[model samples]
Target: MARVLVVDDDKNTLKFVRLHLEEEGYDVIEATDGRDALKKLKTLPCDIAVVDVMMPFMDGISLTKEIRNTYDIPIIILTAKDQIDDKAVGFEAGTDDYLTKPFETKELVFRIKALLRRYVDSESDNDPIRLGNILILHENYSIKIDTKTIKLPLKEFELLYLLAKNSQRVFSREQIIENVWDLDFEGDNRTVDVHIKRLRQRFSHLSVPFSIRTVRGVGYTLEMNQ
Candidate 1:
């Protein structure tokens, strides 16, 4: 499910938006003001953020700027102000879509889905995985970090590719083996760990700390700073 953050000063507005988003099978996180919104955003991972333009403590424009600076996640601006300048300012602050107040719940839902589709489709268009200072050319099965080139065996390369493809999400060793290696590869799960360790070593010299994290008793994840 997609995680969405809704920010609005009015309690009624926040509740209403959260209820509608939950009804649509989305995981909703809410904040009553822009400052609260930023705090919540940093605590959890979210796919998109819905922000109200006229918020307390900080406005949507400022909040959008902060979000854009740290993450490439999609943002939709919700507001009572419908002026052209207001819309332009939101876009300038990196909002992916704009919605005015009193919008129909269905219309809001549609806009959110459209924005998400566009963002996801753009990522798919890239074909290869690129993050921070590292790039993995999946089609060519090659990897590079800035001006440095790294070599990998087929197994190691495939393992790195899968982790980087799904970047921040955790994956169990069994899941990694099934997707990166053969479905029926009867090797020990430890093989997955070995390759991940090697890949991290090659990337440790880069500016961004790209590490393969071990989620104890759960799995592993590639956490790249970008």
Candidate 2:
């Protein structure tokens, strides 16, 4: 059974969510606030976390950032506000998905299952990906090149992993966006370009044996230097 961490200040909300999740055969962990959530995370391993935006001690955004920094688990942010800006803030804070308050427990369950499916599929292979001298560690979300270890933000790391894993295969901008970001991503195709640029900039000085090449009018591919 998958373990889920549900963090919210409202006792009723926690009970409501925990009940539904437990019904779905998930091992549920409850935290009244962000600080308490972090404490629970330290002791118990959770596959995913559902965090509310409003909480004492640490807000959901701050808690999400902290979790992203330390754990590889997916996060879903819940809020009463349905504003696009609010969602942008949640995504920026490293949340994999977002849910507004007064949501149906069934919808939340679907989202949880979807996120779990994606994460489990991505990690189905436990071996680290290697391209020439570059090592992509999916376990810790870090990369090793030669003697250097570099940590990238979650999105950047995922982008690089997708490209490197399918090296030499050209992925259209649409495909890249759909795979790296969610299908509901509000950003434009330029988002892919921006991430590609950052990845190139990050490794430009390194002695790597691969390159991310843009196929004019098509998309991008990671090419091994020959």
Candidate 3:
């Protein structure tokens, strides 16, 4: 059974949602606020989370950022705020989807099922593109060269994954930023350079057939070193 974590300050809402989710054959976990949700995440792993934006001691946006950095689970923000800016902020914080409050239980259930299916299917599709004998696991967020398992910071991992996926295809720095950072980023271009430097340092000792080659005046690509 897929476990769903529902975080809301309103106890009545939690009870209502939990009852419906349980009836649909999902294991439901409850938290009164974002802080409590994080605590639950540390011990109780859930497949996805339904988080409310307005809450005491750490709102849903902040919680979504933290979860994106640490966990691989999907988040759906439940909020009464229907303004575009609010939704933008939630998306920038890495929420998988957004649902405004006064929502129907049927719609909520349908969204949950859809998001889970979408993420699962995408994970299978990515399938860890291999370059120069190095395997990049999209779902696992780790790189493997031979028997060694190397973990990277979130940004560094994302950069590496993108390049690996498009091996031999050059990606300009602008394209890299657009894809990896999305629209909410305000960092300068050097951000990609710094991450590339770190990735090179990590893979330096590995005997891989491919390397991240910098194409001056353009961008970068993972190319065969033959």
Candidate 4:
């Protein structure tokens, strides 16, 4: 059973989340604020954390920064702020997923399951796969080059993994959507473009000898310069 730490000042919100998660068979731990949550986590082992962005002391963003620096577990940001900028800041602070306020219990459960499946229960095969100079650790969903290691979000990591595994092979937009986001994704097809753009920018900063390129009308591909 996976232990989850949920941090929120709102008692009603905490109760609601705990109820659903406990019903799903998760061992739930609750905290009233980020400071309290951080103290608990250091002594208690948890698989993941569901955090709220606004709180009395040490907001979610600050807590996320501290967690990223010290903990390996994934974090899901639960905030009422649904703006793109807020979401981006959360991601920048190392959150793996984000959920807005006023969300359904089923949706919350699904996101938790999705993240756990991606990062925790991943049954990735070990095959010493190298894309250019970077090493792909499938099991950890991390990439390494020299002494540096990078952890990416689930979608960006999956897209990079798929393209890197295939090398020069191009994946169509529809195929990518079906593979990464799955069929139930209600978002428009343009989301793939958004992810691809992010992947390109991140990879570029690393000075990797590879590029994620658009195939015009076809889709996209990872081209390695060797």
Candidate 5:
């Protein structure tokens, strides 16, 4: 089973999360603060971490940065519903995802599963994905089209990799946001549109065999040309 480290100063919150996560078949290790969490990390191997924004001694953002520096596991930050700035800081600190407080247990489970899948994919897939003349190197976060190699930002590379890995599969705007961003992304459909537009602009001049096509009211799909 996947071992999860859950850190929060509130005893009630920790109990609640532990109970629900344990019910979902996860091995949960609880810590009352960031210091305790680091102590636990020393002896325990955790698959992922769920950290709350508010904590004594060390806050979640600081702890996330420490974990990012030391561990390769994914982290999910828990924040208050209105603490938008916390989410931004958490992202900057290297959190893989965030869950707003007053969240459902099912949503937490979903995010954990999603992050695990992504973590595993990155660890296992070392070979570049090739589609005709286009090559996607996941490790380098770059793509090669014909003779030109372009390095992209983290999100752009993930978005392109998602679509290209599942070439010809249609993904709705909501689905794209959920997969590329997070399930709790505060942005709207236009975020996906902007990213899509940027990707198109980047490779518009190339003689590529695949195109990211918009499916009207449906969404976007990377269609391989015949």
Candidate 6:
């Protein structure tokens, strides 16, 4: 079951939400205030959070900002404030979705389900993947470098996408083959090396020289921070 954290100051509201979410087969964790929510977050294994904007100890906006500093978990802000600016502020503070108070339980459950589906489908968008000055837009399948578009081949894009999806994580040739090439690659790790070399050569003219670093004994890592 998917785990969820529900942070609200009102005891009655928390109890109501917890029971409903539990009935839906979700593991629900509870917090009375934003400060307590942050503490719970440190130890709890929650996939998503339902946070109320008006809390006694720390308020949801501040708590959301603090969580965003390290964690990229999905956050849904529950608030009585229905103004556009309030919603804008929530989003600015890294809220994934916003729901107004006096909401129906069915609507709440539907929103949570939709957000979770989107979150699961696009988990890699949170990663930053840089190739030279070119930035791969993981959420959009496009590339932009120095305000210009970089056309990538279909095969090359998949190769780069998989590497970028796990930035700084080294993968052997056999692993890359199984993932990107769909081959039983039993020969050598040099296949990965060749692709890395070609990717680097293609983007070498930028301010940040594009390159993939090779571990002395391991495999290749896509390192744009170099």
Which candidate wins on TM-score? 4
Stretches of candidate 6 off by over 4 Å are 81-84, 122-132, 135-226
Which stretches in model 3 have alpha-carbon errors above 4 Å?
122-127, 130-226
Per-residue accuracy of model 6 over 113-179 as CA lDDT, tens digit each: 8767655564644454666666876454347877886644323455687877687898776777677
Cα lDDT of model 2 by residue, 185-214, tens digit = 655676677678768888998899999998
Model 2 residue 23 CA deviation in Å = 0.6
lDDT for each residue of candidate 4 in 66-100, tens digit (9 for 90 to 100): 88777877788887744545566676676767788
Candidate 4 has what TM-score? 0.78
lDDT string for model 1 (1-226, tens) is 8999998888998899899999999999988888898888888878888988887789989998888777657787886644546665665565656677778889888877865664555344437677777778654446777887664544456677787878899999899878765464434576666666656666676565477889999899988654
Query: Sorted on TM-score, highest at the top, how do the candidates line up?
Result: 4, 2, 5, 3, 6, 1
**Residue-level error in angstroms, candidate 1, position 49:** 0.5
lDDT of 6: 0.71
TM-score of 6: 0.57
lDDT of every model, 2 decimals = 0.74, 0.85, 0.80, 0.81, 0.85, 0.71
The alpha-carbon RMSD values of the candidates against the true structure, listed in the order shown, are 16.5, 4.1, 6.8, 3.2, 7.0, 15.5
TM match of model 2 to true structure: 0.72
User: How far in Å is the alpha carbon of 144 misplaced in model 4?
Assistant: 2.8
Clashes of each: 0, 0, 1, 0, 0, 0
Greater lDDT among 3 and 4 belongs to 4
Candidate 4, superposed: residue stretches over 4 Å from native: 81-85, 122-128, 171-175, 186-207, 214-219
TM-score, cand. 1: 0.55
